[model samples]
Target: MPIILLLQLSNQTGLLSLGDLLLQAATVLHEGVVQVVGSSSAFAAIKSDGSGIIWGDAAKGGDSSRVEHRLQEGVVQVVGSSSAFAAIKSDGSVFSLVSTACGGDISCFEHQLQEGVVQVVSNYLAFAAVKSDGSVITWGDAAKGGDSSRVEHRLQEGVVQVVGSSSAFAAIKSDGSIIIWGDAAHGGDISRVEHRLQEGVVQVVGSSSAFAAIKSDGSVITWGAPANGGDISRVEHRLRE
Candidate 1:
Protein backbone atom coordinates (compact mmCIF):
# COMPACT_ATOMS: atom_id res chain seq x y z
CA MET A 1 0.00 0.00 0.00
CA PRO A 2 1.02 3.63 -0.42
CA ILE A 3 2.86 5.38 2.39
CA ILE A 4 -0.09 7.76 2.65
CA LEU A 5 -2.48 5.08 3.95
CA LEU A 6 0.12 4.00 6.48
CA LEU A 7 0.24 7.61 7.56
CA GLN A 8 -3.51 7.54 8.14
CA LEU A 9 -3.26 4.32 10.15
CA SER A 10 -0.72 5.93 12.45
CA ASN A 11 -3.17 8.71 13.11
CA GLN A 12 -5.40 6.15 14.83
CA THR A 13 -2.73 5.84 17.56
CA GLY A 14 -3.20 2.06 17.70
CA LEU A 15 0.13 1.44 15.95
CA LEU A 16 2.79 0.26 18.36
CA SER A 17 6.11 -1.71 18.42
CA LEU A 18 6.15 -1.71 14.60
CA GLY A 19 5.99 2.06 14.43
CA ASP A 20 9.59 2.33 13.28
CA LEU A 21 9.22 -0.15 10.40
CA LEU A 22 5.98 1.48 9.24
CA LEU A 23 7.58 4.89 9.23
CA GLN A 24 10.60 3.63 7.30
CA ALA A 25 8.31 1.88 4.80
CA ALA A 26 6.37 5.08 4.24
CA THR A 27 9.59 6.88 3.25
CA VAL A 28 9.99 4.64 0.16
CA LEU A 29 6.48 3.53 -0.91
CA HIS A 30 4.55 5.65 -3.40
CA GLU A 31 1.74 3.27 -4.34
CA GLY A 32 -1.77 3.52 -2.90
CA VAL A 33 -3.26 2.16 0.30
CA VAL A 34 -6.33 0.04 -0.48
CA GLN A 35 -7.85 -0.21 2.97
CA VAL A 36 -7.09 0.10 6.68
CA VAL A 37 -9.00 -1.34 9.63
CA GLY A 38 -8.37 -1.44 13.37
CA SER A 39 -9.42 -3.37 16.41
CA SER A 40 -9.14 -1.85 19.86
CA SER A 41 -5.41 -2.41 20.11
CA ALA A 42 -4.14 -2.75 16.51
CA PHE A 43 -4.57 -1.81 12.88
CA ALA A 44 -4.56 -3.77 9.59
CA ALA A 45 -3.73 -2.24 6.22
CA ILE A 46 -4.46 -3.62 2.77
CA LYS A 47 -2.07 -3.24 -0.13
CA SER A 48 -3.28 -2.26 -3.56
CA ASP A 49 -2.90 -5.92 -4.52
CA GLY A 50 -5.27 -7.02 -1.72
CA SER A 51 -2.58 -8.20 0.68
CA GLY A 52 -2.34 -6.86 4.26
CA ILE A 53 -0.02 -5.74 7.05
CA ILE A 54 -0.81 -5.33 10.71
CA TRP A 55 0.80 -3.73 13.79
CA GLY A 56 -0.26 -2.95 17.33
CA ASP A 57 -0.47 -4.85 20.61
CA ALA A 58 -0.11 -8.52 19.58
CA ALA A 59 -2.78 -9.77 21.92
CA LYS A 60 -5.33 -7.29 20.61
CA GLY A 61 -5.14 -8.00 16.84
CA GLY A 62 -1.78 -6.27 16.17
CA ASP A 63 -0.24 -9.38 14.62
CA SER A 64 -1.10 -10.80 11.20
CA SER A 65 2.09 -12.83 10.66
CA ARG A 66 0.23 -16.10 11.21
CA VAL A 67 -2.04 -15.48 8.22
CA GLU A 68 0.47 -13.48 6.16
CA HIS A 69 0.35 -16.06 3.36
CA ARG A 70 -3.44 -16.07 3.09
CA LEU A 71 -3.56 -12.28 3.08
CA GLN A 72 -1.10 -12.06 0.21
CA GLU A 73 -3.80 -11.89 -2.42
CA GLY A 74 -7.52 -11.88 -3.21
CA VAL A 75 -8.55 -10.18 0.04
CA VAL A 76 -11.67 -8.16 -0.68
CA GLN A 77 -12.64 -6.80 2.71
CA VAL A 78 -11.51 -6.88 6.33
CA VAL A 79 -13.32 -6.09 9.58
CA GLY A 80 -12.43 -5.95 13.27
CA SER A 81 -14.29 -6.56 16.47
CA SER A 82 -13.16 -5.03 19.76
CA SER A 83 -10.08 -7.24 19.76
CA ALA A 84 -9.96 -9.42 16.63
CA PHE A 85 -9.82 -9.21 12.84
CA ALA A 86 -11.75 -11.13 10.17
CA ALA A 87 -10.87 -10.92 6.49
CA ILE A 88 -13.02 -11.92 3.54
CA LYS A 89 -11.38 -13.10 0.33
CA SER A 90 -12.49 -12.91 -3.27
CA ASP A 91 -13.58 -16.54 -3.24
CA GLY A 92 -16.03 -15.82 -0.45
CA SER A 93 -13.76 -17.59 2.01
CA VAL A 94 -13.21 -16.02 5.45
CA PHE A 95 -10.11 -15.97 7.65
CA SER A 96 -9.87 -14.67 11.20
CA LEU A 97 -6.73 -13.76 13.09
CA VAL A 98 -5.58 -12.83 16.60
CA SER A 99 -7.23 -12.61 20.01
CA THR A 100 -9.07 -15.93 20.31
CA ALA A 101 -10.68 -14.49 23.39
CA CYS A 102 -12.61 -12.03 21.24
CA GLY A 103 -13.66 -14.07 18.17
CA GLY A 104 -10.36 -14.48 16.31
CA ASP A 105 -10.40 -18.29 16.14
CA ILE A 106 -12.33 -19.73 13.22
CA SER A 107 -10.97 -23.27 13.38
CA CYS A 108 -14.15 -24.73 14.79
CA PHE A 109 -16.37 -23.13 12.13
CA GLU A 110 -14.01 -23.61 9.21
CA HIS A 111 -16.63 -25.63 7.42
CA GLN A 112 -19.36 -23.05 7.82
CA LEU A 113 -17.17 -20.14 6.68
CA GLN A 114 -15.37 -21.88 3.82
CA GLU A 115 -17.30 -20.02 1.14
CA GLY A 116 -20.40 -18.07 0.12
CA VAL A 117 -20.17 -15.49 2.91
CA VAL A 118 -21.84 -12.24 1.84
CA GLN A 119 -21.59 -10.06 4.93
CA VAL A 120 -20.03 -9.99 8.40
CA VAL A 121 -20.90 -7.79 11.37
CA SER A 122 -19.28 -7.51 14.78
CA ASN A 123 -20.00 -6.01 18.14
CA TYR A 124 -17.62 -5.60 21.09
CA LEU A 125 -16.66 -9.26 21.35
CA ALA A 126 -18.32 -11.36 18.64
CA PHE A 127 -18.93 -11.76 14.93
CA ALA A 128 -21.88 -12.83 12.82
CA ALA A 129 -21.46 -13.77 9.18
CA VAL A 130 -24.24 -14.03 6.63
CA LYS A 131 -23.74 -16.62 3.90
CA SER A 132 -24.97 -16.57 0.30
CA ASP A 133 -27.44 -19.31 1.20
CA GLY A 134 -28.92 -17.02 3.85
CA SER A 135 -27.44 -18.90 6.80
CA VAL A 136 -25.72 -17.11 9.68
CA ILE A 137 -22.48 -18.06 11.46
CA THR A 138 -21.62 -16.56 14.84
CA TRP A 139 -18.57 -16.85 17.08
CA GLY A 140 -16.68 -15.03 19.81
CA ASP A 141 -17.44 -14.50 23.51
CA ALA A 142 -20.69 -16.46 23.98
CA ALA A 143 -21.94 -13.87 26.41
CA LYS A 144 -21.40 -11.15 23.84
CA GLY A 145 -23.26 -12.60 20.84
CA GLY A 146 -20.87 -15.36 19.78
CA ASP A 147 -23.20 -18.21 20.65
CA SER A 148 -26.23 -18.17 18.43
CA SER A 149 -27.08 -21.76 19.22
CA ARG A 150 -29.99 -20.56 21.28
CA VAL A 151 -31.70 -19.47 18.06
CA GLU A 152 -29.78 -21.73 15.69
CA HIS A 153 -32.92 -23.23 14.23
CA ARG A 154 -34.29 -19.86 13.23
CA LEU A 155 -31.04 -18.92 11.46
CA GLN A 156 -31.17 -21.90 9.12
CA GLU A 157 -32.28 -19.76 6.15
CA GLY A 158 -34.18 -16.72 4.87
CA VAL A 159 -32.02 -14.32 6.87
CA VAL A 160 -31.65 -11.07 4.95
CA GLN A 161 -29.80 -8.89 7.46
CA VAL A 162 -27.92 -9.16 10.74
CA VAL A 163 -27.35 -6.32 13.22
CA GLY A 164 -25.32 -6.26 16.41
CA SER A 165 -25.53 -4.49 19.73
CA SER A 166 -22.61 -4.28 22.17
CA SER A 167 -23.51 -7.61 23.77
CA ALA A 168 -26.09 -9.13 21.47
CA PHE A 169 -27.14 -9.80 17.89
CA ALA A 170 -30.40 -9.63 16.00
CA ALA A 171 -31.27 -11.25 12.71
CA ILE A 172 -34.09 -10.08 10.46
CA LYS A 173 -35.31 -12.89 8.24
CA SER A 174 -36.96 -12.74 4.83
CA ASP A 175 -40.36 -13.44 6.34
CA GLY A 176 -40.04 -10.33 8.50
CA SER A 177 -39.57 -12.34 11.67
CA ILE A 178 -36.78 -11.39 14.07
CA ILE A 179 -34.35 -13.61 15.98
CA ILE A 180 -32.19 -12.36 18.83
CA TRP A 181 -29.38 -13.80 20.93
CA GLY A 182 -26.49 -12.95 23.22
CA ASP A 183 -26.65 -11.13 26.58
CA ALA A 184 -30.31 -10.42 27.31
CA ALA A 185 -29.39 -7.21 29.07
CA HIS A 186 -27.81 -6.01 25.86
CA GLY A 187 -30.95 -6.55 23.82
CA GLY A 188 -30.15 -10.17 23.06
CA ASP A 189 -33.31 -11.47 24.67
CA ILE A 190 -36.59 -10.40 23.09
CA SER A 191 -38.94 -12.79 24.83
CA ARG A 192 -40.64 -9.85 26.50
CA VAL A 193 -41.98 -8.61 23.17
CA GLU A 194 -41.71 -11.79 21.14
CA HIS A 195 -45.29 -11.77 20.00
CA ARG A 196 -45.07 -8.23 18.63
CA LEU A 197 -41.99 -9.10 16.55
CA GLN A 198 -43.45 -12.03 14.62
CA GLU A 199 -43.69 -10.30 11.23
CA GLY A 200 -44.04 -7.06 9.26
CA VAL A 201 -40.71 -5.76 10.54
CA VAL A 202 -38.92 -3.68 7.93
CA GLN A 203 -35.66 -2.63 9.59
CA VAL A 204 -33.68 -3.03 12.78
CA VAL A 205 -31.23 -0.65 14.48
CA GLY A 206 -29.20 -1.24 17.62
CA SER A 207 -27.81 0.80 20.49
CA SER A 208 -24.96 -0.46 22.68
CA SER A 209 -27.37 -2.54 24.79
CA ALA A 210 -30.70 -2.21 23.06
CA PHE A 211 -32.48 -2.64 19.71
CA ALA A 212 -35.27 -0.82 17.95
CA ALA A 213 -37.17 -2.29 15.02
CA ILE A 214 -39.43 -0.40 12.70
CA LYS A 215 -42.30 -2.33 11.20
CA SER A 216 -44.12 -2.09 7.86
CA ASP A 217 -46.87 -0.17 9.60
CA GLY A 218 -44.47 2.63 10.63
CA SER A 219 -44.58 1.66 14.29
CA VAL A 220 -41.45 0.84 16.27
CA ILE A 221 -40.77 -2.06 18.60
CA THR A 222 -37.97 -2.04 21.15
CA TRP A 223 -36.67 -4.42 23.80
CA GLY A 224 -33.57 -4.65 25.96
CA ALA A 225 -32.63 -2.37 28.85
CA PRO A 226 -35.39 0.25 28.86
CA ALA A 227 -32.80 3.00 29.20
CA ASN A 228 -30.95 1.97 26.04
CA GLY A 229 -33.94 2.54 23.75
CA GLY A 230 -35.72 -0.76 24.38
CA ASP A 231 -38.89 1.12 25.27
CA ILE A 232 -40.64 3.95 23.38
CA SER A 233 -44.03 4.23 24.99
CA ARG A 234 -43.13 7.66 26.36
CA VAL A 235 -42.73 9.03 22.81
CA GLU A 236 -45.22 6.75 21.09
CA HIS A 237 -47.82 9.46 20.74
CA ARG A 238 -45.44 11.79 18.92
CA LEU A 239 -44.59 9.14 16.29
CA ARG A 240 -48.12 8.61 15.11
CA GLU A 241 -47.67 11.20 12.39
Candidate 2:
Protein backbone atom coordinates (compact mmCIF):
# COMPACT_ATOMS: atom_id res chain seq x y z
CA MET A 1 0.00 0.00 0.00
CA PRO A 2 1.11 3.57 -0.65
CA ILE A 3 1.25 6.10 2.14
CA ILE A 4 -0.59 9.39 1.75
CA LEU A 5 0.97 12.61 2.92
CA LEU A 6 -0.56 16.02 3.57
CA LEU A 7 1.40 19.23 3.20
CA GLN A 8 0.39 22.79 4.09
CA LEU A 9 1.84 25.96 2.65
CA SER A 10 1.13 29.55 3.65
CA ASN A 11 -1.22 31.38 1.25
CA GLN A 12 -1.55 28.28 -0.92
CA THR A 13 -3.02 24.93 -0.04
CA GLY A 14 -3.51 21.91 -2.27
CA LEU A 15 -3.81 18.17 -1.86
CA LEU A 16 -0.80 16.23 -3.15
CA SER A 17 -2.41 12.96 -4.03
CA LEU A 18 -0.04 10.06 -3.46
CA GLY A 19 -0.48 8.82 -6.99
CA ASP A 20 0.18 12.28 -8.36
CA LEU A 21 3.44 12.49 -6.46
CA LEU A 22 4.49 9.02 -7.60
CA LEU A 23 3.63 9.84 -11.19
CA GLN A 24 5.71 12.97 -10.98
CA ALA A 25 8.60 10.90 -9.67
CA ALA A 26 8.12 8.30 -12.39
CA THR A 27 8.10 11.04 -15.02
CA VAL A 28 11.57 11.96 -13.82
CA LEU A 29 12.74 8.36 -13.92
CA HIS A 30 11.46 7.67 -17.44
CA GLU A 31 12.81 10.97 -18.67
CA GLY A 32 13.23 10.30 -22.32
CA VAL A 33 10.88 12.25 -24.62
CA VAL A 34 8.43 10.07 -26.55
CA GLN A 35 7.34 10.21 -30.20
CA VAL A 36 4.27 8.37 -31.58
CA VAL A 37 3.82 7.65 -35.28
CA GLY A 38 1.30 5.87 -37.55
CA SER A 39 -1.89 7.66 -36.50
CA SER A 40 -3.14 9.86 -39.34
CA SER A 41 -2.47 9.63 -43.05
CA ALA A 42 0.75 11.59 -42.69
CA PHE A 43 3.79 11.45 -40.37
CA ALA A 44 5.05 13.85 -37.73
CA ALA A 45 7.52 14.10 -34.84
CA ILE A 46 7.49 15.83 -31.46
CA LYS A 47 10.96 16.26 -30.00
CA SER A 48 12.01 16.56 -26.39
CA ASP A 49 13.15 20.10 -27.02
CA GLY A 50 9.48 21.15 -27.43
CA SER A 51 9.56 21.30 -31.24
CA GLY A 52 7.41 19.49 -33.81
CA ILE A 53 7.54 18.55 -37.53
CA ILE A 54 5.16 17.11 -40.09
CA TRP A 55 5.53 15.58 -43.54
CA GLY A 56 3.87 13.35 -46.15
CA ASP A 57 0.45 13.39 -47.81
CA ALA A 58 0.18 16.97 -49.00
CA ALA A 59 -3.57 16.57 -49.06
CA LYS A 60 -3.48 16.06 -45.31
CA GLY A 61 -0.76 18.65 -44.73
CA GLY A 62 -3.02 21.71 -44.31
CA ASP A 63 -0.57 24.48 -43.50
CA SER A 64 -1.21 27.32 -45.97
CA SER A 65 2.07 28.61 -44.56
CA ARG A 66 3.46 27.20 -47.77
CA VAL A 67 4.36 23.53 -48.12
CA GLU A 68 7.93 23.41 -47.02
CA HIS A 69 10.12 20.44 -47.68
CA ARG A 70 10.65 20.18 -43.93
CA LEU A 71 8.97 21.45 -40.76
CA GLN A 72 10.43 23.76 -38.14
CA GLU A 73 11.72 22.42 -34.82
CA GLY A 74 10.11 22.84 -31.37
CA VAL A 75 7.59 20.03 -31.42
CA VAL A 76 7.04 18.16 -28.16
CA GLN A 77 4.86 15.37 -29.59
CA VAL A 78 3.54 14.05 -32.91
CA VAL A 79 0.77 11.72 -34.18
CA GLY A 80 -0.16 10.56 -37.66
CA SER A 81 -3.02 9.05 -39.63
CA SER A 82 -3.55 7.87 -43.20
CA SER A 83 -3.95 11.47 -44.36
CA ALA A 84 -3.15 13.86 -41.55
CA PHE A 85 -0.79 14.68 -38.68
CA ALA A 86 -1.23 16.45 -35.33
CA ALA A 87 1.37 17.77 -32.91
CA ILE A 88 1.62 19.43 -29.53
CA LYS A 89 4.47 21.81 -28.81
CA SER A 90 6.07 22.58 -25.48
CA ASP A 91 4.27 25.95 -25.38
CA GLY A 92 0.92 24.13 -25.33
CA SER A 93 0.06 24.87 -28.93
CA VAL A 94 -1.67 22.20 -30.99
CA PHE A 95 -1.20 22.14 -34.77
CA SER A 96 -2.45 19.84 -37.46
CA LEU A 97 -1.23 18.91 -40.90
CA VAL A 98 -4.28 17.74 -42.72
CA SER A 99 -7.03 18.91 -45.01
CA THR A 100 -8.05 22.19 -43.34
CA ALA A 101 -11.58 20.86 -43.22
CA CYS A 102 -10.45 17.63 -41.67
CA GLY A 103 -9.76 19.36 -38.35
CA GLY A 104 -12.37 22.11 -38.81
CA ASP A 105 -10.40 24.88 -40.55
CA ILE A 106 -7.37 27.00 -39.62
CA SER A 107 -9.01 28.52 -36.56
CA CYS A 108 -9.51 25.10 -35.08
CA PHE A 109 -5.92 24.17 -35.79
CA GLU A 110 -4.67 27.37 -34.20
CA HIS A 111 -6.76 27.14 -31.06
CA GLN A 112 -4.79 27.14 -27.82
CA LEU A 113 -4.85 23.67 -26.40
CA GLN A 114 -4.97 22.77 -22.73
CA GLU A 115 -1.61 22.67 -21.01
CA GLY A 116 0.60 19.78 -19.92
CA VAL A 117 0.28 17.43 -22.86
CA VAL A 118 2.78 14.82 -21.79
CA GLN A 119 2.03 12.26 -24.48
CA VAL A 120 0.17 12.10 -27.79
CA VAL A 121 -1.31 8.94 -29.35
CA SER A 122 -3.35 8.23 -32.43
CA ASN A 123 -4.88 5.43 -34.44
CA TYR A 124 -5.75 5.14 -38.10
CA LEU A 125 -8.71 7.45 -37.61
CA ALA A 126 -8.13 9.76 -34.62
CA PHE A 127 -5.79 11.31 -32.05
CA ALA A 128 -5.55 11.17 -28.24
CA ALA A 129 -3.61 13.11 -25.66
CA VAL A 130 -2.67 12.20 -22.10
CA LYS A 131 -2.01 15.31 -20.03
CA SER A 132 0.28 15.47 -17.03
CA ASP A 133 -2.88 15.98 -14.97
CA GLY A 134 -3.96 12.40 -15.80
CA SER A 135 -6.84 13.44 -18.02
CA VAL A 136 -7.34 12.36 -21.63
CA ILE A 137 -8.50 14.27 -24.73
CA THR A 138 -9.50 12.60 -27.95
CA TRP A 139 -10.59 13.85 -31.38
CA GLY A 140 -11.30 12.31 -34.75
CA ASP A 141 -14.02 10.07 -36.13
CA ALA A 142 -16.87 9.72 -33.61
CA ALA A 143 -17.32 6.10 -34.55
CA LYS A 144 -13.64 5.50 -35.22
CA GLY A 145 -11.82 8.26 -33.26
CA GLY A 146 -13.68 11.59 -33.31
CA ASP A 147 -14.43 13.01 -29.85
CA SER A 148 -14.89 10.21 -27.29
CA SER A 149 -18.08 11.85 -26.00
CA ARG A 150 -19.80 8.68 -24.90
CA VAL A 151 -16.93 6.98 -23.12
CA GLU A 152 -15.51 9.92 -21.20
CA HIS A 153 -16.33 8.16 -17.95
CA ARG A 154 -14.00 5.30 -18.87
CA LEU A 155 -10.98 7.53 -18.35
CA GLN A 156 -10.46 9.29 -15.04
CA GLU A 157 -7.63 10.70 -12.98
CA GLY A 158 -4.71 8.37 -12.10
CA VAL A 159 -4.39 7.06 -15.65
CA VAL A 160 -0.68 6.76 -16.25
CA GLN A 161 -0.52 5.57 -19.83
CA VAL A 162 -2.49 4.91 -22.99
CA VAL A 163 -2.16 2.75 -26.12
CA GLY A 164 -4.12 2.70 -29.37
CA SER A 165 -4.88 -0.12 -31.73
CA SER A 166 -6.09 0.33 -35.30
CA SER A 167 -9.50 1.42 -34.06
CA ALA A 168 -9.58 1.37 -30.25
CA PHE A 169 -7.76 2.76 -27.21
CA ALA A 170 -6.72 1.36 -23.82
CA ALA A 171 -5.50 3.12 -20.71
CA ILE A 172 -3.61 1.74 -17.72
CA LYS A 173 -3.82 3.41 -14.37
CA SER A 174 -1.07 3.42 -11.75
CA ASP A 175 -2.95 0.66 -9.91
CA GLY A 176 -2.11 -1.97 -12.55
CA SER A 177 -5.70 -2.14 -13.72
CA ILE A 178 -6.79 -1.32 -17.28
CA ILE A 179 -9.69 0.45 -19.07
CA ILE A 180 -10.58 0.14 -22.70
CA TRP A 181 -13.04 1.73 -25.15
CA GLY A 182 -13.85 1.38 -28.79
CA ASP A 183 -14.30 -1.83 -30.75
CA ALA A 184 -15.53 -3.93 -27.83
CA ALA A 185 -14.29 -7.26 -29.12
CA HIS A 186 -10.77 -5.93 -29.28
CA GLY A 187 -9.57 -6.37 -25.71
CA GLY A 188 -11.97 -3.77 -24.25
CA ASP A 189 -12.91 -6.04 -21.35
CA ILE A 190 -9.39 -6.81 -20.18
CA SER A 191 -10.23 -4.73 -17.13
CA ARG A 192 -12.74 -7.41 -16.16
CA VAL A 193 -9.78 -9.72 -15.61
CA GLU A 194 -8.92 -7.68 -12.53
CA HIS A 195 -8.63 -10.84 -10.43
CA ARG A 196 -5.75 -12.02 -12.57
CA LEU A 197 -3.97 -8.68 -12.56
CA GLN A 198 -1.52 -8.38 -9.73
CA GLU A 199 0.08 -5.25 -8.45
CA GLY A 200 2.99 -3.75 -10.42
CA VAL A 201 1.83 -3.74 -14.02
CA VAL A 202 4.31 -1.41 -15.65
CA GLN A 203 3.23 -1.18 -19.26
CA VAL A 204 0.67 -2.27 -21.81
CA VAL A 205 0.47 -2.75 -25.58
CA GLY A 206 -2.45 -3.33 -27.92
CA SER A 207 -2.58 -5.40 -31.04
CA SER A 208 -5.41 -5.61 -33.53
CA SER A 209 -7.41 -8.04 -31.41
CA ALA A 210 -5.72 -8.38 -28.04
CA PHE A 211 -3.89 -6.66 -25.22
CA ALA A 212 -0.51 -7.32 -23.57
CA ALA A 213 0.68 -6.02 -20.22
CA ILE A 214 4.20 -6.19 -18.82
CA LYS A 215 4.43 -6.51 -15.07
CA SER A 216 7.09 -4.90 -12.92
CA ASP A 217 9.03 -8.15 -12.73
CA GLY A 218 9.01 -8.20 -16.57
CA SER A 219 6.43 -10.97 -16.80
CA VAL A 220 3.56 -10.38 -19.25
CA ILE A 221 -0.20 -11.02 -19.07
CA THR A 222 -2.37 -11.17 -22.15
CA TRP A 223 -6.11 -11.47 -22.72
CA GLY A 224 -8.64 -11.19 -25.54
CA ALA A 225 -8.98 -13.36 -28.66
CA PRO A 226 -6.46 -16.14 -28.30
CA ALA A 227 -5.74 -16.41 -31.99
CA ASN A 228 -4.79 -12.73 -32.24
CA GLY A 229 -2.81 -12.60 -29.01
CA GLY A 230 -0.75 -15.69 -29.91
CA ASP A 231 0.00 -18.70 -27.76
CA ILE A 232 0.81 -17.20 -24.36
CA SER A 233 2.24 -20.34 -22.77
CA ARG A 234 5.03 -20.57 -25.34
CA VAL A 235 6.45 -17.19 -24.36
CA GLU A 236 5.35 -16.97 -20.74
CA HIS A 237 8.84 -17.51 -19.38
CA ARG A 238 10.22 -14.65 -21.44
CA LEU A 239 8.00 -12.24 -19.52
CA ARG A 240 9.35 -10.64 -16.34
CA GLU A 241 6.36 -10.98 -14.04
lDDT of each: 0.85, 0.58
TM-score of 1: 0.88
Model 2 agreement with the true structure over 25-117: per-residue lDDT tens digits: 344324443574643344444446543444334465423234222235456656665556666666665556555434323243233254677
List runs of model 2 lying over 4 Å from the truth: 1-41, 45-53, 60-73, 99-112, 145-151, 191-194, 197-199, 217-219, 230-241
lDDT of 1 at 210: 96
For candidate 1, what is the lDDT?
Answer: 0.85
> Candidate 1 — which pairs collide?
2-32
lDDT of 1 by residue, 53-123 (tens): 76677788877767777877788888899889999988999999778999998888989898999999999
> Total clashing residue pairs per candidate?
1, 25
Identify the candidate with maximal lDDT.
1
What lDDT is reached at residue 113 by model 1? 92
Worst 10 residues of 2 by lDDT: 1-10
10 residues in a row with least lDDT, candidate 1 = 1-10
